[model samples]
Target: MSIKEQVRQLWKTCFDDDDAFIDLYFRLRYTDKINKVIEEDGKVISALQMIPYPMTFCGQTVATSYISGACTHPDYRARGAMRRLLQETHRAMFAEGVMFATLIPAEEWLKGYYARSGYATCFHYGLVKKVINSYEQPVDNSVSCLNMSKIDLLKTPQERIYPYFYEQMNRRPCCVQHTPDDFHVVLSDLALSKGDVWIVDKNGVMSGLVFCLMDGNTLSVKEILLSDEADFAEVLRQLAASYRAERLECIVPRADEMHELGMARLIDVASCLKVFSAVYRGEGLYIRVTGDEAIPQNNGYYTVLPGKVSRDMQEGQTYVTFTISELTAFILHDLHPYMSLMLN
Candidate 1:
């Protein structure tokens, strides 16, 4: 068997997934140059896949990587293989100038597992559950919800419009940005990540948009945009009815629930902060970051400036002290978790 096949077998054994699904994943979403593996006696037992993406933070696009499909075989579970892999990944990311690394743990409890590797909670993820109050029996008015062709979205816009469209998508505090090609690549990837982009056009103008996926009886809306409130309810009503959903769930930017849908960790603090246009209004504070006992390099005192990040500065009094997670929240301007990226 090929090494990747062996690794997939290990992944399948651990995650209870089948071969076809595994094949689709490898063929579709694999990133280049960052796949790491631990070999033991001619077999790959542990692996990590780092997929890099451009994330927008406070109106600026920055390089960030998504750490996903991370798994270690049961035989290698207690041998510190995964921890070493993560440490190596972080160092490589820093060297490559990638500012941040974000990931969605397969389960919520796994957040604590990655926290040991300097990953903190930075993503807010949850399903917004709203029962269909009214479903097409008597609609308020007709809202044209149509799926636009890829060609159409890429074309038909003004010369300066494409850049603006991509920019506005990332205007929120910290969002992952995707190009038109990225959208096509994500969707064409064997439809492994399945969803439809529906635009609500009214009177020859596009007013509302929804990107949703059907899960069993529920239609989970990953993104919904309607700048005008007047069209919001009616668009949602149309969406709920059109998708034939039993329950409509939305993942808001900031969640109020007890648990989180996803988590994030900083690969390099200085790199991440450097990408920010400006830090919060202050005379620059000294921060002493603690925790990450497993990784000693991350625990240190530092001085943060508007355009500078210095380490081990003795001149500042540790006015701000926080864990890596808290630092992530701070860098993200409250870390009100939204869809990091690739909702499809």
Candidate 2:
């Protein structure tokens, strides 16, 4: 059978859901690589897709591509369809001189699965916030929050906001590198499509910025960066007050390096790890992790190993051994709890 037929068969069987298929189809179509699928016998058993983005960071200049929507038919699963598709995609990306590939995994266990395939966990953060009712606006105190609605990206000074935003994000542990031009493009698109963006000014200079979106009753903060002198807490409070949102949410790095600038706090560590673990992958089998200190109920390290089993680390780094598939299953939440559910 031809590769195209294999991919069609695989998609039809694996993602039998019409809605999921439609979503997958649209995403694949948007990346402009759907036709790359190899077909055999009028069925698609395997397929791969790539999403391209122009990324700029300090010291390096290059356009990057991210791979997503990878799949193989259920019958072709153990036959190495995924491995071959990934291998081809990686080769193509390398030929294109792509910087790196990134994706949000569909399953947590897929992390270990991808790890064995050559992907690693780089950085992760969580979304958390308190829901406030009434609050005072920062503008009332003469604090300048630039209404992005009034500013034109084409007319604004790129030197003003681009450099500052890039520098601020670079301080975070897992932030992707972005160039001034790349930053401008991203911000310009968001500003045009989203609600008002608030910028905190110092002496007629842009110091901090925040982007907010309203979804039904909730106010979603897409990004928030502030200067050292700017009160991040006040900015958040003012934005929340203006929208009267019951809650505000934005992803923060796990290292909490930006907390001081934003006045943001970490509320749930385990949940954050669980969310992040969905993307990372590892090698080997039957892994174990042991430690010496008391593990916090909410925040604790874990060692992933073979057989979908994970040992919680208390003090020192405990040795762990496990199969790639097992670890993937565990992170994806596909594995059953070895311990009691109440404990988890």
Candidate 3:
């Protein structure tokens, strides 16, 4: 069977929703930039969806691709379909000039599978924030706050806002790669209908802004950028009141000191730690990665490697090296988990 037919059959068996299956199938199949792979017998049983990392991650401009919709049917699980697909995908991505890839892992066991494929953990962070029902008035010395929803990105003041925003966040240790285009993409997605951008104004100037999305009952905050802790807290208050959301959440980098202080008010650290610890089991393994671009957090720290892999204090263990694209797959759980099973 052809690659398209094989993907369709696999989706039919793995997912119950016809609409969702079709949507995902076309997304992977028609994304002209992506490559597809299929495993079959008399009929298609498994499939892998991938695109050149360089193209996906703005690589010609940035360096990685976002991988999603990777699956194998039950009848084909033990046959190594996932592993073969990932191996092939990695090879293709590497040759195409992609330096990295990323995805959200589906299961905990999948973490170990990517390790054997030469991928390592990079960084782990969670969405968390306190919800407030009301905002307090600014005291004589309190910092001023402004809702970005009230401002227009096309206006002169709004245009000036982001340059300062980038300056404040770029200095952070775990910040991700972003550009003006990236900011617009995120804002456009969040502003589906309801306004999603909010700026914290201090003394008549833009001090910081919160970028987020509303999915039913939840407000998913991608980032909260501010010059100080007090301003960050106040922004949260204004956001909750303005959106009328019951809860607020933001995905913060683990190395952020501000996150540590805000964790107490935002999330239950013990629960989050348990989840992270369980997902990451490869500790003490040293792996070197070579790529055109570098993921800053993963470059120096043993604990911050994207996936669950850690440094083994033992006298002997296998040391491995991976490409940036492969490492990005490991962190995002795009590769097969069984491949990393041996590493744990």
Candidate 4:
């Protein structure tokens, strides 16, 4: 089999999801992504997909590679393919000047798999479950003064789609930023995945939207874009009814109860700290970080200010120290952000 074929077979075998959906997911969502693989005797034994997306941190954008669809042939398991492939990918990302690499673990057990590669839980998530019997069908469409509607995302024009996405991301703190081109590619991927995107438009402008994943009778709302609290309840009701979803799980629940959604690793501490520097308000602070072997510059002491950073330590300053992983989580902790479903 060729590389794509080998990956598809391996992915399906490992994940055991619907073949069609998996194929579509790889086709659309992973478009233009960097694929890293470990081959033994000319056969691909393990693979990882690096999907690039811009993540907004403290009001600035950082280039990020989202790692997903990780798979290893069962026969090749217990070997060092996963570790080698991850190390290679991380080095490549850092060389490319990518500041962060992230992933959402499909299974809880896999969390440990990436942590060994220097990933930390940077984003938190919240899930609220509604039983199949607990679901209440939506009411009439015309009941509310607000004109809410559901339309195929393909029908949503390019102009509206990008702006709406930007608006929604801005509404939620600590969201991955998307350009218009990004939305075009992502929406195209969604169409291929046979996913549903329902929107709430006020008058004629798009105000709220939701990205839902459909299983047999359960609907997973992966992303929610809304203007207010009432919009949330309204969209959920309509989506559940439209899709005939029996059980519903929402990733974006109340803020206080949010749990971890994904893992993140700082590929370039200096560059990433620059983005955060715009928001960090403090006297000149001296710090050192023990970095991964792949990136050597990351392990060092530095002088940092609200707008400047240098390798040399300052004369008099507030001193702090962190391992690379600890600093990754510590820097992002202030936002108190929940994991975003859209990234997954």
Top candidate, metric lDDT: 4
Give the TM-score of each candidate. 0.81, 0.53, 0.55, 0.84
Give one digit per residue, the lDDT tens place, for model 4 in 75-186.
9898888988888998999989898888888889878877877887877767767756545555567876455565577776878556776876876557666667667666
In model 3, the runs with Cα more than 4 Å from the true position are 1-30, 39-45, 51-62, 126-128, 131-147, 150-195, 199-207, 214-219, 227-230, 255-344
**Of 1 and 4, the candidate ranking higher by TM-score:** 4
Q: Please, what are the lDDT tens digits per residue for candidate 1 over residues 117-224?
A: 767776655455678855655433433343222123333333333343464566666676666655554444324456665655555555555566788878777666
> Global lDDT for candidate 2?
0.49
Give per-residue CA lDDT, model 3, range 1-344, as digits (tens): 65665666666677565564365346433353464565465665655555322211111123444455667888778877777776666656555545444444555675567544444554355446666444343332233434444455334344555686667655543234445644544444344334456666766766677766676655667676776633565566666656666677766654233221100000111222223344445444455544423222233213323244343333454546645435444433431111100000
Quality of model 3 by C-alpha lDDT: 0.48
lDDT preference between candidates 1 and 2, better one: 1
lDDT by residue (tens digit), candidate 2, 175-209: 34555544554555554445555666766677787
- In TM-score terms, candidate 1 sits at 0.81
> Model 1: residues >4 Å from true position, as ranges?
18-20, 136-168, 179-181, 188-195, 227-230, 255-259, 290-299, 312-316, 319-323, 333-335, 340-344
- Which regions in candidate 2 have their CA more than 4 angstroms from the true location? 1-36, 42-46, 52-64, 71-79, 96-99, 126-128, 136-139, 143-164, 170-174, 178-196, 255-344
Candidate 1 lDDT score relative to the true structure: 0.65
Q: How many pairs collide in each candidate, listed in order?
A: 3, 54, 26, 2
Q: What TM-score quantifies how close candidate 3 is to the native fold?
A: 0.55
